[model samples]
Target: MIRSTRILGLAPRVAAARATALWPQLYHERVVDHYNNPRNVGSFDKNDPGVGTGLVGAPACGDVMKLQIKVDDQTGKIVDACFKTFGCGSAIASSSVATEWVKGKQMEEVLSIKNTEIAKHLSLPPVKLHCSMLAEDAIKAAVKDYEAKRAKLSPSKQRGSGGLINFIGDKAAIV
Candidate 1:
């Protein structure tokens, strides 16, 4: 027998197994998995051109999440994702799942992954719904940040026009 089993004996192990079986009633297995072993839980350099960052706070739940995504500028595919969350298990799991899902996906496609889907996968209760929403918001905010940064660096802004100009406006051309 293992040391734990030998010392504590089989009764506790059996009880733990039973509790594991019952724990899913309050938290889904997936949520438990993500919470116990959170994925991509960290920060990337916010100033990095390839990285996009999102910060969301839920005042009601007092949860704050910072999610970051790294994308291939040419391909628009997410190369990596990371998140840091200060909140409940559902919130942590939501962000963790978001990072896992967004990695390797196109930015546009990542936008389609919804809060409902995250909530469903985690079996979140109604009270915890906001947590999932925050995760979704994080993804959008990050993508928006990336797009805005890219726009600043775009070739259209570099055309020998002096300062920034409205590239799409015909009247403002070559000024």
Candidate 2:
């Protein structure tokens, strides 16, 4: 009976210790911030020539992300970015951070963005790593869509298209 009472007393202490140790591993500050308040969560004008739309999904996790980018034709730089993500905390944070990083970056530079960067920034675990990959793929898809649209225009239209500058209000110019 004495041994049973001692074991019961240790249970509370052990549970408290476990909770304290697991708290940080289960949640990252940045991840929680982004998850609660996602950035650039919207859709741009899909039919606009300056807008490139990318829609991607992960079958295993049933996550879907739609990312859009508006480019400056003359400078070949991203002028604005937006995204709508339907997934877990990691997926939402990945897409949110991707949008923030893509704006003001050139198409080529945006393509070079790696999944590792997103994962590291959000402090994602192994299971959530795939969310970063999906974010990267979504950016590439949007860029490809832009390129494809640009290719279809006539030379005169192509030249004129470069003059359409996107106005992204409230977002600071990174460079």
Candidate 3:
């Protein structure tokens, strides 16, 4: 009986070793780095006029990501960015990289960012591509929230009745 128990314990150890070996192969170096040391893992005040908050989720994976940006009121540039994600490593890494990319970028520039770019940067697999898409949706939602808040605060400044418009330059580019 003791001999049989020892063999069963060894079986578990062998399986664990195999899993450990496959772990590194499953995720790219950048994904692993971000997962281990995620950057901008926090939240900003959603009610702050200069802050925009975006909360998005993937129904397929039940992954939720909240990304926020603190924009410079004067320059219309994202002065800082942060996120809080409750999901897998890929989702966390996607949000972490999203925050990093948005910092110091103007609102329009930030909106132009694509999920494919994020996916490529993280080398996320096809199955994990939705994680990057979640990040992208979060960014767009946050920017939309920011614009909505601004519109509510300054209705007179807003051209037309409803709809988002770019307030950075002289041209009122409708979004």
Number of the top TM-score candidate: 3
Model 2 lowest lDDT segment of ten = 156-165
Write out the backbone clash pairs for model 2: none
Candidate order by lDDT, decreasing, is 3, 1, 2
Candidate 3 residue-wise lDDT, 20-67, digit = tens: 677679999999889989999988888899899999999878999999
TM-scores of all predicted structures: 0.77, 0.75, 0.83
Query: What clash pairs does model 3 have?
Result: none
lDDT of 2 at 78: 100
Off by over 4 Å in 2: 1-25, 155-175
Can you rank all candidates by TM-score, best first? 3, 1, 2
Compose the digit string of candidate 2's lDDT tens values, residues 17-103: 876676457879888888878999999988888889999999999999999999998899999999999998899999999999999
Better of 2 and 3 by lDDT: 3
**lDDT, model 2, position 63:** 98
Q: What C-alpha lDDT does candidate 3 achieve relative to the native structure? A: 0.90
